[model samples]
Target: MKRRAFFLKAGLAGLVVGNQGLTSCAPGPKLYGDKNFYINKGYQAIPKLKLSKDRIIKETVGLRPFRESGPRVEKEMLNNKTIVHNYGHGGSGWSLSWGTGNQARNLVKTTDAKKVALLGCGTVGIATATLLQESGYDVTIYAKDVPPNVTSNLATGTWSPSSRVCAEEKATPEIKANWEDACRFSFRRMQMSLGLNDIIDWGDEYTVRKQKPSGSNISGGHEMFHIDGLNPEWKTLAQKDHPFKADYVRRRSNMIFNIPSYLNFHLNNFLIRGGKLVIKDIKSLEDIDALSEKVVVNCMGLGAKAIFNDEELYPISGQLSCLVPQTEINYKLATDGAYFITRKDGIYLGGSGIERSWDTTPNRQLTEKWVDVLSDLMKDMKG
Candidate 1:
């Protein structure tokens, strides 16, 4: 698990020569012996992160709302109200917010209601509200918690569209098409927001390895590149040019979010657009019926599990630990299960995705375990 298991879980390792002989295991490959790969031979090594327990200013957990058939973006009738379910995005919520928000807006347009009610003020909720408001609908967001306090604030904030969104077995052709639409829209929207300072920025991330990656992508999910309009700027870095843990490296462009700043920007935009937020904990469908608006957009994240009684909805609980800011590094790294992204707020590091865990409080043991693993990883990296 020290390396092989980590890479496998991260979907970075392509395949392995086990008893089965060259069976595929993961999606990415850093297969060695390629001298023509593009890497900055003089690349400066990323400084080791301060991962001590005390360096963790705050520890937060998020329940990534996951459904086997992708997110529930359909509409239904509940107590004379048109309910648009927009939850269950799993780990792709932040990444797909705008696109799914667009879908929810389109659904809302079909309804006669002008005053739209958005449930759950997480990333999805705020994004939906903004879109609806801009579309000339009066929108209100009701939730027990708001951003910086919600699960969206705890996101790793990387623009990855298909991370555990749906199992490959469940993704049909139609679903794949929907995924492509959502991913493209979301990615384009992010591109439009690129000049927003620390709120959203393009990042250069490295997926480093000691051995070259081999085989094709075995981890099945929607591939954005398959979508006609999308083109990725991924490059293969040769070992000589690679700086960290080198044998080979994969460099790609990632749309990163400074969670706090990004959340603030959205909240501020929603508010500026005449949006209203009411603190409410909706326990049942009956509670939804009590709302003033006839059309309700549900963006409740894991809260939908209880409200909608969606058996398919489950939590992939994730935890993140941060270190003090460092300006010497401007890039991010992904290896094993851990990923590191530097933000103006702090340098975020995390790698815990426990399925079906509802615990929100930080686990000291798990936090230390992630820090230790990352610390060891950094130590093992070559200059």
Candidate 2:
């Protein structure tokens, strides 16, 4: 998940294919496409991906709990018990999972209670439980559904926090510090987590452009926020260095988590480590307080709209169409609205964010539209 939608808003141009030519291949950022020159090696992907209606193994939707004010990570008392909220990262849910989980765990520490209840078993819920358990607390996850079945599985699973996290003007200065902390912690965890068939790895990402997008970094309905440890500059890439048929190209190193495997790893780890999971559809906030754990952490994502009655939180509906996996397709390419990434599970082609659209049913027409856009971009490659 290169977060093209957010990058387009930030007007972030190329940075992946260094400042040198494709032939020299130095380590520094460079661009070289003034001539019609084309290098022939290390620049080819298995062209002509088979993205068809029949090839679509599964189509899932996730309603990003987007809030104009930013994610909820505060605590309040209800029914003589403490309930800590930790939801609403919008498209950055998977990316910010561990960091936000740590943030929630920090809140849990203020209370002397050692037993905690986690609501929702998606990325955030699971992460929160793992952290709490590691901190020597008795933890149980209460959710209507678990991973491989939750909305978290549908996430593109890219490490991009500023991807619709919040508007700069709307976010308080403290939220920015929190974002940095969460990002740094999560990045370190990803580096130390299971890798090489475990669904977490470093991958190359390309942000291809037809022309420089119109907007300053923070203007034009877009936002450009910086993370402390990550590189903000996108180096230019000549057309000869990359495969896409775009006028300008930028590249960067990105951390990627294959959703299906990543979720499975977390769930299995939590269970094997003595964490308990209870499958119960909570009917109300009072229902949570009735649970055995004294402290309840709400990680309900979009469900909070009804569960907690927070009107500011809304769904940013997103859908991803996946093709059969091609292991050689290791990198990702993102244009205006469409993006492509390949993982062990499948080659992913996506996506669209329709505000307030909660339809989980995959639209064949929308899928086809993205497929066509990606196909046309790759149609020029020789491989």
List model 2 lDDT by residue over 1-383, tens digit each.
57978787565444433433553665665555522233244544323455556777766676888987778899998877889999988877777788989999999999999888889999889888999999999998999998778988888887777677875578788888888888788777777785546678777777777776765651111333576446445668776676566777788777778888888888899999999999999978778767877789999998888979998898888888888786556777777768877777887777678787888888888778887887666665533
Give the distance in Å from residue 368's predicted Cα in candidate 1 to where it truly belongs.
2.9
Give lDDT tens digits, candidate 1, residues 56-138. 78677777888888988999999789999888888888888999899988998898899998998888888888889999998
User: Which structure among the candidates has the greatest TM-score?
Assistant: 2
Q: Point out where model 2 deviates above 4 Å.
A: 1-39, 42-54, 194-196, 217-224, 228-233
- TM-scores of the candidates are 0.83, 0.84
Model 1: how far is 149 from its true place, Å?
Answer: 1.4
Q: Ten consecutive residues with minimal summed lDDT in candidate 2?
A: 215-224
RMSD of candidate 2 to the true fold?
A: 14.2
Clashing pairs in 1: 29-213, 30-212, 30-213, 31-212, 31-213, 32-212, 65-90
Error of 2 at 164 (Å): 1.2
